[model samples]
Target: MLLLLPVLPTPEFWITLGNYVGLYSIVAIGLVLLTGVGGMTSFGQAAFVGLGAYSTAYLTTQFGLSPWFCLLVGLVITMASAYV
Candidate 1:
């Protein structure tokens, strides 16, 4: 990435890849906590991540809502879904 600093206009793709890697790292942590500690496997963490991401993306793009407000909304949606 550093090598492309002068050759490329910007490293947007690398930045996006880094974001996805970070997101999946959290997923891995969640899986280890649940499977190793509880002795069971589940994809709940990834599901919640997708739910929150979709909710926030939709709200922000369609309604032009503030990211912070959309974040709160997404959290609420995810928690409600998790509870039920």
Candidate 2:
């Protein structure tokens, strides 16, 4: 299956699809770890992702911050929230 991927005519589409699939896989693995290993049952992951997204959006839109700065601020806020 992996070897046949190069045969696709639209490599860009495949790349985009792989990117999304990889991202979802990471989220899924995190959820699995939280539920299976940590014995936690919650949808906190989605909330955290939302918090980061909103923080970045607000910082960039309201303050006209650079993308890198927004990313840093978002990560800081997310980490702080997780700590609390």
Candidate 3:
């Protein structure tokens, strides 16, 4: 199945598919780290991701922040919240 990804007809579809796969792989790695290495059950992973997403969305939409600034702000907020 993975070998057939490049055979997709539309280049745009392939790009979108690859983007999703990359995002899911990141989430899976995070989950594995939390559950396996940290010995912790982290059902709140989605919540943390959602919080960061909302923070970035709000900063970009409401304040017209640059993507890099929004990303930095989102990461800071997410890490602070997790630490607390």
Candidate 4:
């Protein structure tokens, strides 16, 4: 009966969905840690995301850094900003 219910999507669809699910799961877990464990009720998680993204953009575009290293720098900046 369950299998008869409109045969599921193709493997590609499942793979894409899995990718997004994993990405969002990690974000949600981070937020959960911030609010639940750290007891910091921050409504600025998106801001942090934007800051990291922009930092990455700046590092890559202006400094001509490798994407991987730029990401590491971005992570450091984000963590430092959060701690401050």
lDDT string for model 4 (1-84, tens) is: 546534765577766786679758977898989999999988799788888879998999998999779978998999999999
What is the C-alpha lDDT profile of model 1 across 16-78, one tens digit per residue? 787789868977787888899988978777799899989999999999999779989999999
| Cα-based RMSD of candidate 4 | 7.3
Alpha carbon deviation, residue 83, candidate 1 (Å): 1.1
Candidate 2 positional error at 34, Å: 2.0
The TM-scores of all predictions, comma-separated, are 0.64, 0.58, 0.66, 0.56
Q: Give a tens-digit lDDT track for model 2, residues 3-84.
A: 8777856578778898779868977898989999999998888998789879998999998989679978998999999999
Candidate ranking under lDDT, highest first, comes to 3, 1, 2, 4
Q: Which of the two, 1 or 2, has more lDDT?
A: 1
TM-score of predicted structure 3: 0.66
Counting clashing residue pairs in each candidate, in order, gives: 0, 0, 0, 0
> CA lDDT of each candidate?
0.87, 0.86, 0.87, 0.85
- Cα deviation at 38, candidate 4, in Å, is 7.7
State residue 26's C-alpha deviation in candidate 4, in Å. 3.6
Best by the TM-score measure: 3
The reply for model 1, stretches above 4 Å from the true place, is 1-18
